[model samples]
Target: MAKSKDISVVIPLYNEEESITELCKWISRVMESHGFHYEIVIVDDGSTDNSWEIINNISSENGSVKAVKFKRNYGKSAALNTAFRCSEGDVVITMDADLQDSPDEIPELFKMIKEDGYELVSGWKKKRYDPLSKTIPSKFFNYITRKITGIKLHDFNCGLKAYTSELVKSIEVYGEMHRYIPAIAKWNGFNRIGERVVQHSARKYGQTKFGLERYIYGFLDLLSITFVSKFKKRPMHFFGTMGTLSFIFGFIVATYLIGEKVYINLFLNERARGVVEQPLFFLALTALIIGVQLFLAGFLAEMISINSNKKGDYLIEKKIGL
Candidate 1:
């Protein structure tokens, strides 16, 4: 087993050749000044530039600097998740490699995790240096996330965040779900999340890797994570409820139409329009079909959830006896 350190700074980079060396030096300086036994785990997410080469050179020189290079770009979340598994620090701090996230915030974040007892501490970039195009959407995204997750953090997507070793190890970050790490942590029972106003610097190296499309995907990911976290084991709760309501609604509509036709024809002794002629009949038929499909879908999901192997889905905190 690898030796544990006081702190581990995990950075996920893609094509950040210019800033890797300087960022490592800055982190080293801060760690040394603070008397922290720290390791820097930098994951190169399949960068096409010299980023991986620079990382390799840095790791060769600094024994504390660990590096991982992907053959192809897997994305920031994959990089972070991989590093999280390999990190052996009591406190794990994550920051962007674009130099936008300041290394100066590391000490206070570390203190928040160690002394203040926060399971996860996310950085809030109150005054950002990005253009309105990016900042505006980011603000809106964070606002919606805050409302949904109820975490009260202003910046949920900020890369400069800190987590306890246990918190990092317990939660899984995948897809574009890295933006909702706080929400994930909360769902995992790490509710003591903290936020600190951190220094956000303008990019010192390459251009922004992400575009506006990220916000669109980010919104979809938020809904996804929320649903999966709440109902991963019991998907029937969502699908079954919707299916039941839809089926009942269709049944009621069809019943009303049929009853009206029967009453008009039999009681008034007058010819009535056939229930099949009304557009409502088709609507009801469509709804009924959809409802049955949804219900069967839910049933299948339940069966899969029951039969699926969940060997490593849970982490045991303690054991009393065999």
Candidate 2:
């Protein structure tokens, strides 16, 4: 096993050849000035450029610099997730390789995690240099995320963040869920999430990899995480409730129509429209069928949830003398 360090700065990069060297040097300077026993873990996400070569060169020169190069480009989430598993640090800090996230924020973030008892500390870029086209949607995205996840962080997608080693290991980040790490931490019971206003520099090299479509995907992922967190253990709660309501509504409407027809035919002695002929009869039938289908779906989900193998599904747990 590799020796653990006081801090591990994990950077995930793709096609960032121009900025990788400078970023590593800046991080080393910060760690040295702060007297931190630190290791820099840089993951090259299958960059076709010279980023992986630069990483290899840096790691060769600096023993504290550990690097990984993927066979092909996985998204940022995969890069970060893999690095989290490989990191051996008491406190883990993640920053973008684009140099937009400043290395100066490391010390304070480290303090927040170590001294302030924060399980995770996310950076907030209070002032940004990006164009309105990007910044506007980002603001809206953060606002909606705040409302849904209730994490209270102004910037959830900020790559410059710090975490306790335990917090990072306890959570699993996948899909486009990188933006919701704070929320994921909270769901995993790491509720002591803090935020610091950090400097966001203009990109010194390469263009932004993400586009406007990310916001749409982000919103969908937010909803997905919320649903999974709330209902993963008891999916029947959601589906069953909706199904029951729909079934009751349909039953009530059908009964009322039948009763009205019977009254008109027997008591009033007048011809009444056939129940099958009324448009509401078909509406009620459709609702009933949909309700049954949803209820059955919930039943299957519950069965799968009960029978699925749950052992070894969780992250590492501390034991005294196991």
Candidate 3:
């Protein structure tokens, strides 16, 4: 194991061969000028381009640079999670490899965790250089995320952030949950989260690896995190509550239909439509079945949770040790 350093820069990149070398050099310059002992841990998320080759060359020339290349593309969250495991630094700083995330913010981010008593410090790209197509959706989603997660961060998906080793190691970032790191940290009891307005640069090299589909996945992941954070240990609370309400509503509807049928048959000459002939009866039956299934689903999920591994798994094709 490498000795614990003052800072660990974990950059997760995919097909960013064009920018890897320059980004590393920039980080080295910033950290060296600040007189901080730092290690740059670059994680290549199975880039098909020459990214791994560039990373290897950079690592060979610079002892401070270490890298892990994935066996396949596992997404940014998986890359970060794997790097966090391998990082041996007091303050773990994560940034993008595309050079858009400035390395100059490292000093303050380190101070926020090491000196200011914050568990996690997220970067806010106050003035993004993205096109309207990206910025508009990002702003709307950030608004919704702030309201839902209560983290008060302007940019939850900003790749530049800092964390105490304890905070990063305590939380798991997987399944596109990298966008909700602050929220995840808060849920795990690291509530002293701070934000810094960092410099965001325009893409000077490759195109963005992400599409609008990421935002769609991000919204779903936020809902998943909200549910898991609250009911991870006791899923019965959520599923059972919803199931019980649905079952009650359906039972009430069924009882009403049956009672009306009996009343009409007893008091009027006209025959009441059979309860089975009514659409309400079928709808009520479907609701009852759905409620039962949901309750069963909760039970099944609880069982899997008990036996499933909470820590994520990933395949590393190669490692360049420091």
What's the true lDDT of residue 142 in model 3? 96
lDDT of 1 at 87: 89
Clashing pairs in 3: none
- lDDT tens string, model 2, 163-219? 999988987777788899998899889999999999999998889999999999999
Which candidate would rank higher by lDDT, 2 or 3? Answer: 3
Q: What lDDT does the true structure give each of the candidates?
A: 0.88, 0.88, 0.90
Give candidate 1's error at residue 191 in angstroms: 0.6
Q: Indicate whether candidate 1 or candidate 3 has the larger TM-score.
A: 3
Q: Candidate 3's residue-wise lDDT over 99-206, tens digit each?
A: 899999999999989889998998999998989999999999999999998888989999999999998888888888999989889999998999999999999997
Q: Predicted candidate 3: what Cα RMSD to the true structure?
A: 2.0
Q: Estimate, for each residue in 1-322, the C-alpha lDDT of model 1 and write its tens digit.
A: 7656999999998888899999999999999999999999887777789877787788778889987777777788888888898788899999999899989999999999999999999999999998999999999999898898888999988999999999999988887788999999999999999999999998887799899999999999999999989988898998998898889889999999999999999999999999999999999988898889889988999999999864322221211110
Residue 287 lDDT, candidate 2, scale 0-100:
85
Q: State residue 101's C-alpha deviation in candidate 1, in Å.
A: 1.3
Q: Sort all candidates by TM-score, best to worst.
A: 3, 1, 2
Off by over 4 Å in 1: 1-3, 309-322
Show where candidate 2 strays beyond 4 Å: 1-3, 307-322
Give residue 92's lDDT in candidate 3 (0 to 100). 96
